[model samples]
Target: MTDRTLYIVVCGAPLASRVGDGVRQARDRGWSPYVIPTDAALPWLEDQDLGGAPVITGNRKLGESRRTPKADAVVVAPLTFNSLNAWANGNATTYPLTTLCAALGSRTPTVAVPFAKHDLAAHPAWLASLAVLRYAGVAVVDPHDGSAVSLEPITSGTGDAVTQAFEWDWALDRL
Candidate 1:
């Protein structure tokens, strides 16, 4: 119901399956939520989801068919380790990542919340990519960084745990 649009990019994480919660939260916060799902996250979203906002897919062309509203800001929630690494290394293989890259290039207000097991975060490439994104002006929210979002490690396959642990609203507020 608001003019301001918040682009929520959902990556392939366990929490991505419940992205609806954050979409609703964004709406409650007076933001028109637009969903951009990474290739790996698409299976979680049903056709009727998102309350009719234009849903962008990863395998698609650069331009979406629908006349989507311009994003006032962006949030990539549950940013998976794979996606983050790809994004940081300038590999915009998916539409979601490509959009995020464009927003960063244009200096849009963008926030990314990485969600992965502790082991993934310990990877050298993952650590380096976090810095790359931060250096490019994205607010990368780390679970151990002692920030607003107190991220906890959710088991890889537990739907309930993933839904409960993900900081959906926290990521939305930053946008």
Candidate 2:
């Protein structure tokens, strides 16, 4: 356990299946990571090895205390288009979204890895949302190469390959 807390926010995308990689990398870097997954991400996490990190899902009970410590940094991997748009629009409808919104509002150091295919990435909102997040100081890394300079959309039918090729160090390095 370490004093630094890293919030790993996962979404429902092929890359989500590798969240364990991120958790392990975070811990190796001296960050006590907490996985916060969107409901849709549950399936992908079914067989993941989180290395004993806690996964926080859904809303907390009224009388329950906060489950995790304050985040020192946040990494949103496999940032699906839906969650990305919702987060950029400040929609805190779900637990994951609420956590993202709060992290953004608090100006927490954040890194987001968007995993949208070419067609979806072509939408006007896609680039706009990236712009919005960048303007807010979030490090937007390209899932393919961890390039913070440019983010290329994943080609159709290449999601699996892209996901497999992604490295957690790409996002963690930025932090």
Candidate 3:
């Protein structure tokens, strides 16, 4: 196995059911994956096994001891707009996902594949936060176009389109 371990953080999104697919994809590509879930995304991981990757969640206290040591990268799949805003505004410690995002900071190569509705993506604060994060060196990617996918309105995404838009390869490329 490669020395690269990907910490895949899952947030609450409709496509969260496919998180296992993300883990499998990462592993197949030679990076071991540790699936960490936000509280809202916990159900999607219910009764599922992610090879040997820890599903750390439950208020972020689930697997501190078992974390993939020095994960070469962090990929937040299905990153919700709320987490984006919070992470941008120094609200990191408030929730599990944001806490990890904040703690990892710019030290770790982090990629965020956002999944949000059109309206949330259009908010000024959302736009500003994304820009700020990018400036701070976080790779905030859009799942749909393989582009930065900043705070602008996503033109073609909904349902399966949204699911299909998740760019697994692009995420790894950023790291």
Top TM-score hit: 2
TM-score of 2: 0.98
The candidate with the higher lDDT, 1 or 3, is 1
- Per-model CA lDDT versus the true structure: 0.75, 0.94, 0.72
lDDT of 3 at 100: 53
lDDT string, candidate 2, 1-175, tens digits: 5889999999999999999989988999999999999999999999989999999999999999999999999999989999999999999999899999999999999999999998899999999999999999999999999999999999999989999989889999999
Candidate order by lDDT, decreasing, is 2, 1, 3
Clashes of each: 0, 0, 0
Sorted on TM-score, highest at the top, how do the candidates line up?
Answer: 2, 1, 3
Please provide TM-scores, in order, for all candidate models, with all chains considered together.
0.82, 0.98, 0.82
Instruction: Name the regions of candidate 1 deviating beyond 4 angstroms.
Output: 58-66, 142-162
Clashes of 3: 0
Candidate 1, residues 1-175, lDDT tens digits: the string is: 5988889898876667767877888888898988898778887786435776668764645674744567789988778889889888888776787888888888889888778787776788877888798889888664334264344444456545655655665666566
In candidate 1, which residue pairs get closer than 3 Å at backbone N, Cα or C atoms, i.e. clash? none
Worst 10 residues of 3 by lDDT: 150-159
